[model samples]
Target chain A: MLTLDRHTYEAIVTHARRDHPDEACGIVAGSVGSDRPQRFVPMANAERSPTFYRFDPREQLALWREMDDRDEEPVVIYHSHTATEAYPSRTDVKYAAEPGAHYVLVSTRDPQEVEFRSYRITEGVVAEEEVQVVSALP
Target chain B: MAIEVRIPTILRPHTGGEKAVEGEGATLDELLADLDVRHPGLRARVVEEKGGTNQLRRFVNVYLDDEDVRFLGGLSTPVADGATVTILPAVAGGAGGVAGG
Candidate 1:
């Protein structure tokens, strides 16, 4: 199960909504070995396509370096699906290089309702997990 | 000249879990070839053979110092002694061809 504080949850939802009709992507970083996510980093979708998303190569380098410098890892790798359900698509599964991260998928298909879910995509197998939203992290 | 190649977490298995490995070469291509000699299969993950020519994979981000190799000369990017080469898998994905989005 993936546990997220209310603020972080809201931040992810808001970013997804703000980029509706196009895919939005980002990562939540936390101390290495800490499953808890403490930083929200929204990234530019270089593809900027409604059906595709990619982090700018240069930005990706900087992001990885920052995480390394802080002794952190990507606890949560997230993206939005403007028209589909909150699930990993084939494209998503194929590019899941971080076998240790919680792959979060948010859907803004319904402006009134947001579908938030998490999964572990490892070695071509994707297993969905429960998302527990708490008022704050312990 | 010896270049220090920083391996990402996903590719650590090929490096025997060593985060950084030393390689020798004046160009990126030669460096990868040398890496594969020590860490078998490491080169295959980052470089692909296309139409009888070897090239870096599109999704693997390789940076020489702080500059992305793609913006430089790609596999032919020149490398100097003591340069830091970091490899990162791009964080990317989206709807597939048949998936509605």
Candidate 2:
């Protein structure tokens, strides 16, 4: 199960809805070896396509360096889908290289209802996990 | 001179869970090849032969110090002593628009 603070959860949903047709991508960085997501870091979608999203390489390098300096890791990797449900697509699964991250998929297909889901993708296998939203991180 | 290469978590398996390693090469390709000599199967995961030529896998990002190798000479990018080579898997992917539910 992935436990996230309500603020972080709301922030991700807002980012997804704000991007709307174009997919939004970001990560929540946490202390190394800590599964808890504490910091929300949104990334530019270099692809900027509704069907595809990629982090800008320059920004990615910066992120990595900063993480290394801070001894942090991306605990939650997230992206939005404009026309599909909140699930990992074939492309998503194929590119999921971070085995330790919780892949979160948000669906902005519905104007009124946004679907938020989390999954663990490792070794080409996708396993959906339960998401628990709380007022504060424990 | 040896080039310092930082390995990401996803590719650490190929490096025996090493976070960083060193290799000698004048070019990025040579560096990776040199590293592969010690850590087998590491290069194959980051680069693949395409159209009879070696090309980086689409989902992988490699940098020579701060500049992305794609902007330079790619795998043939020149690397000198004390350069830091970083490897990271691209964080990407999205829906194909098939499932609307």
Candidate 3:
């Protein structure tokens, strides 16, 4: 199971709505080997296409370096699906390099509802996991 | 000191099951070539010769010191000793045709 505080959860949802039509993506950094997300970083979807997203290469580089300096890692990698259920597509499974991170997907297809889900994609395998939204860090 | 290349799990076979390998090159292209010399067929998976030019395959994302080489300078991106270069397959964004709007 994956756990997130309400603030972080809302931040992801807001970013998803802000980038509606175009996919939104970002990373939540956490202490190395901690597996707990503590930092939120909303990234620019380089593709900026309604059906696609890619991190701005330069921005990703800089941010990743910053995380490295802080001894952190991308514990939660997230993206939005505007017209489909929150789930990992085949491509998403194919490119999941961080076996230790949570892959979160938020679907805003329904005007009144948002489908939030998490998964662990490792070696072409996609395993949906439970998400617990907490009021504060435990 | 040599540059460190972190290989993804899928590509571990080429490196004799090693997750990270050492290579030497002034540029990413040269580094891949050097790696190919040792691993023999590893570069083809990460790069391709297209339209009379060598380009990183669409699915491949290579980062030099956490910065993507595509934005830094593509294959011509320079590398210094002790840099940590990572190669990962591109996910979600353009992976396997779009599944949603």
Individual DockQ of the candidates?
Answer: 0.60, 0.60, 0.37
Ordering by DockQ: 1, 2, 3
User: Candidate 2 vs candidate 3: which has greater TM-score?
Assistant: 2
Q: Per-residue lDDT for B84 in model 2?
A: 95
Docking class for candidate 1: medium
Q: How does candidate 2 fare on TM-score?
A: 0.97
The CA lDDT at A138 in model 1 is 83
lDDT of 1: 0.92
DockQ of 2: 0.60
Model 2 interface CAPRI class: medium
How far residue B49's Cα lies from its native spot in candidate 3, in Å, is 5.4
Arrange candidates by lDDT, descending. Answer: 1, 2, 3
Error of 3 at A69 (Å): 1.0
Local lDDT at A57 for model 2? 90
> Model 2, range A1-138, lDDT digits (tens) per residue?
999999999999999999989999999999999999999998989987888898999999999899989999999999999988999998899889899999999999999986999999999999999999999999
Query: What C-alpha lDDT, on a 0 to 100 scale, does residue B89 get in candidate 1?
Result: 89
For each candidate, give the interface RMSD after superposing the true interface residues on Cα. 3.1, 4.2, 4.3
> In candidate 3, what are the lDDT values of residues B24-90, reduced to their tens digit?
9999999999999999888998988888999898767799886778889999999999999988765
